[model samples]
Target: MFLLVLLQVLQPAGAQFCPDLCVCSGGAAELRSVQCGGAGMSALPVNVPPDTVKLRLERTLISRVPRAAFYNLSELRFLWLSYNSVTSVHPSSFVNLKALRELRLDGNLLTSFPWEGLRDMPRLQTLGLNNNRLSSLPAHAALFLPNITYLDLSSNRLTILPAELLDLWFPLPELQKGPVRRKILGLHDNPWLCDCQLSMLTSLSSSLGSPVVLMDQLLMCSRSMAPSGMLLTRAELSRCTRPSVQPAATRVVSPLGSNVILRCDASGYPTPTLTWIRTSAYTDCCQQNLLQNSEQPPRILESFMQGSPRVGVRWSIITLNGLSYQDAGEYRCQARNMAGTSEAPIKLKVMGVTRLSRFPKRKPKKTPFKSSPKFRKPNQTLPEKESPFIFPPLKNKIQKV
Candidate 1:
């Protein structure tokens, strides 16, 4: 057999150009690449290989990722820029990385999701964006990341999950194949409003032995029987979605100087929860102060929409501070244990004015001091009145002070 040698192009400059973007140690022979994560780079660093397989820029100061940031990096497989101060992931940011497999972008400042930016990575397998400030997932957010198997979405501020999340097939259909099922799901640590709208998540929990596990346990309930709190375990959550066993009505009552009480009167396999929250500015009062557990309340929150269909997450008030307007806002009553949280929202409106009345002055009865009864002189001889003794003119005038 003839001996064969494999020749690889060597670049001496790769060792010298390791700036704050990455730190390369040893010589080029042992160094595969450089990673400059959290380097505070304003833009992509200089001297990075176009074909580098792994690039980590997490927690960096890079605000604007240019379109050509990774131009011609056909061999690039892994790119991590999570926890950076990045506000936006520009459109076409990752268009050239067709071979990318894993991308980590959790813990960044993304107001709206970048749906289009991720479509170009056809081979991307794992994506992480767990801890961000996303109130709601965009409709069909999973379409862009179809190939993702492992997703991390813990520790975010998500009030209402998209209805599409119920249609799990649409988001990730590819994971259904192969002998080893693609383990694809991550939804803990989100402030999931435990309501009828989220009944689907409760239902799904039953089909799977557990709430599909993907991320860590950092979920907080945005609306529940209580103020902000964490959600319960998966098994209990499944029982919460079962159909009612009794037909009931929600009753709300206000108590004297204590927290309000929200009650639910729905019949289901397990009793549901009652929770509340402040209305969002985008919605009118009719939509605001809504029942967190019910899609709609049996009555309009303010009776403005009286004819509207009745849903059943009831509210009762236990007013604190004599019930003043300042105490008015939104409150959530959440009921959750091993089962996931179920909640309802009640808006407290101090009906009529809430002012204290001055105490009434008590009338004084005319209590006549009755004259002592005049009785005839006792049978015994009345003491004889002594003859009036006449005193003389008197002593000398008292001396003046």
Candidate 2:
């Protein structure tokens, strides 16, 4: 017993301190890293050495990440949680990893982004969320990734872009035309609906200066309409505008003090501006008054996205409230743009009874939208005009056309 006690007292203190599942090699409290990769672990290993900087759990059977999973590892800088079956992450799972630089969550079963999970990672540089089942991202989610330099959102299902997405993500100063501006914004392998609304995103793509790219080659759109499988780089407004009224002119009937809506659809680059004008020989109570001062004016202009190709059937709708005798007239829905303008008229017949006209409505606007060259290797060279985009013409990470 005396000899045993003496031997223990002389032994190294690190032996009993190391985690049972992990293989510790360094001296006491000085372990550099831990690798539980392919260890078939279902959860994070706790009681890690205090000085440990790298922790790898790749190819593990871990299914979920519990709250404050890494709270004790304040010094952890590199975390590898990829190639696992992780599906859910508690909002506080990564809150304590303030020093984490790179987080790999790819090849998981995640259906949605846990934006709240990254609340405290100020030094996080790269975020790999690729090859997941994410269908959408919170509109304000990009606001939380200012320090992130590389982001991967490839392979998922998304049809529309969030409103004011570019404005909220990259500030105006960072978007100024120049060399070396934007970072790697991967948006490949998703079904994008390229329509007038998509013009907003394409316009943003143009403003994103040199040295930065959003995976131009992978920028493609698909739909059952005229254009399908078209590259976004060739989807310029000027190249895709054909203005015309959606439906043939008709007559609208409504009662006094009732509500009514007149709609017109047009197609073009920059989405043609809509103007509602009261026209017709209205010598009756309805006069030129509509051309002058009027309170409770039109509130909004509604537009629709049909998921067709470029500018596939844009709409302009106007609402009229508290209708009176003075409101009865021939109203014109004019669609205008730099290319030109087209007007479609509707006659209003007010009566006490609600009725539908036996007349038929017009057919859809006929126009085909699609284009761009075949795919090529990144190392291959190509012509100037055949190239998709040439903006920030001077230079970028990928050479400017």
Candidate 3:
């Protein structure tokens, strides 16, 4: 009985039996580390202690990670699953790893990752995804990993990246102030396309004191307009010109109380910003005044803009709802970039009255008693009153009597 009591005192509180072919080490109060590798394991160990802070599973035969695989390990901080045959991971696999700081999944057969699951790991800073077969990444991946400092994406099959990701990676010079933290980004050993978009990467990499640190490997383009397998640093990208706009319709005719959609497309080397502006109103009195004031800025209309990064093209669209006579105007589609600016004009014409104003006019009714001879007056005519339905004739139109 005394020996049994001593054995009980040596065990940890709420401790469970460790898995076979694995090793666990810590004091009697808690388990701090677990290492499982090359033990012919086909799946993750289920009996890992809840208090484990570090877990390493290397050279295993695990194929995929299921949801809630580590739900019981809340204190886990450092996880290394290198050199496994992992092909995919569930979106919710890391939902419970709130305290996870560094995650390494290098040397796998993954073609894609569950980027949405990264939101659960707010403290994650170092991510190792090199030596995989990823061809593309989501445009908003940077939004999920806001605190990422070290990102390894070398030896992949990436060709083009979205403009949204580049904008976040290198913000405007005015917005970058104060002491910038050192960030390491590994983007070598990929087949990058040589285009106006790729030129941005070369220019940004040459900056003297940039906070970002790209690996020392030289970048080369696999496909380009000039020649294949050309060095990115020596490519002639200055031949790319400013944006040009192509309007769908130069003149549009619509009736009042109707809807109309205007569309225009722009193409350039460095993508350009598309804007819709109202250059002149339809009012006759304001038409001359608007044309005389050349310095007056045109009114900008709310529009939706979308881009295709692969082809370096963008489209702008605007919908006019409940068209009124006041909506008739000349609209200009403007595309601007570092190279230069271009514009295309579209004239809109509105006709016919609105449905709400098309009701028949009613005349005042005459009562028999009021019009009787007994109430008649001699040679005194009732004051003439004009009807409210009378409207002025349109400018430059003849009125029939």
Best of the candidates, lDDT: 3
TM-score of each: 0.50, 0.52, 0.61
Clash counts for the predictions, in order: 38, 2, 0
**Residue-by-residue lDDT tens digits, candidate 1, 188-302:** 7677776543544544443554424444444455666324564544323433442221112233334334454333333232444332343422223332343234333332232
Candidate 3 clashes between residue pairs 3 or more apart in a chain or in different chains: none
RMSD of candidate 3 to the truth, in angstroms, is: 12.6
What lDDT is obtained when candidate 2 is compared to the true structure? 0.64
- State the TM-score for model 1: 0.50
Instruction: Report lDDT per candidate.
Output: 0.52, 0.64, 0.75
What CA RMSD would you report for each candidate? 20.7, 31.7, 12.6
Judged by TM-score, which candidate is best? Answer: 3
Weakest ten-residue segment in model 3 by summed lDDT: 388-397
Q: Candidate 2 versus the native: TM-score?
A: 0.52
